[model samples]
Target: MAVAPTPPGRRERNKQAKLDRITAAASELFAEHGVDDVTTQQIADAADIGTGTLFLYARTKGELLLLVQNAHYASALERGRTAAAGTTGALDGLLALLSPVVECNRVQVDNGRTYLREMVFGDPTEPHHAEALSIVAQTERAIADLLSERTRLGGEEAAAMAGVVSAVMFLNLAPSATADASVPEILATMRAQLAAILPG
Candidate 1:
């Protein structure tokens, strides 16, 4: 009798496994030491791979940083979209979108804050800076569309509100230089601010 053939999907699974290992190592290093302090060699060591192998996945330390941050955002966005799909109203959809962000911020507060600082105020000419900005813009547009569908707000107003909400969320994620606040406190404050800005 002929033996069963090996699954053809194993290669893709293996590749994803490697990527996950690298990303996890990068996230831990980045959280412990700021992105500026973490080197590619160190990342490779943390990931238990040769430096050259790390280079195959990331061109530079900045690229790795961006990759980590993008992965976080994308994951959260997927969760948000999934939650929003089940909601009945625009406000509910907006709440669903923001829920994942708030949850992510609480879970990965240190890494998320570091990534945001570098993305927003870092060298404007950097490619990651542009990419991060584009991602934010796209997210804002998605929020605006959701709002427009639920309320009487026009496109411009919805867009403006989305921008405002984005700004508030960014500020909420900022790392404290002194005393640290609890995650519950931060989420409560964010929720209150968002509620205040959204229409009744």
Candidate 2:
């Protein structure tokens, strides 16, 4: 007889259901009308949660953006990791890994500006913010792993280099994220900036 998989506990099932409702509602509204045009009340109503409960999940619109975008960012990191894994060239691998991130910011555009800006000063303890940080850490880890595989650098050196590369990429992308720049141009600039710092 095939054993039935254990179901999630009640509390976990309820939590996941609520999270699904919130993310689905937020993603739909943000995609259809843009984040600037959406309201917390509308999101809460769409998710079938009280306004107060929505606040419990996300304290502000910016945090709500983080919460809504967390899943997308995580998926991007995974895609980037996959891109990195298929290459031997350090720079190409790194570029492949980060292009999706820049593209993500490009897709979000205006909302991305708020999310990126708020991220600088956002509370790490917040659930969405923590998830965002974890995604970034995963990107950094991918870079470090690539470096370790391709370079003779020590683990510490690879880790430090990975952090530097990630920071520079984000900085390079910040202004470009909101500008009229094309994706190819943004990627070109990221490659140029990265090339300048890579040990020759």
Q: What is each predicted model's overall lDDT from 0 to 1?
A: 0.75, 0.82
How would you encode candidate 2's per-residue C-alpha lDDT over 1-21 as one tens digit per residue? 999999899998988898789
Candidate 1 regions exceeding 4 Å error are 1-24, 31-38, 47-63, 88-91, 175-179
Residue-level lDDT of model 1, residues 1-200, one tens digit each, is 99998875987797677778888998888878867778888889888888888877766776677777876776787788788888977656876787777666555455567667767766666665667777777779878988888877899999999999888777877757411655566657767787777886
Per-candidate TM equals 0.72, 0.89
Worst 10 residues of 2 by lDDT: 169-178
Error of 1 at 101 (Å): 1.9
* lDDT winner: 2
RMSD of each: 5.4, 2.5
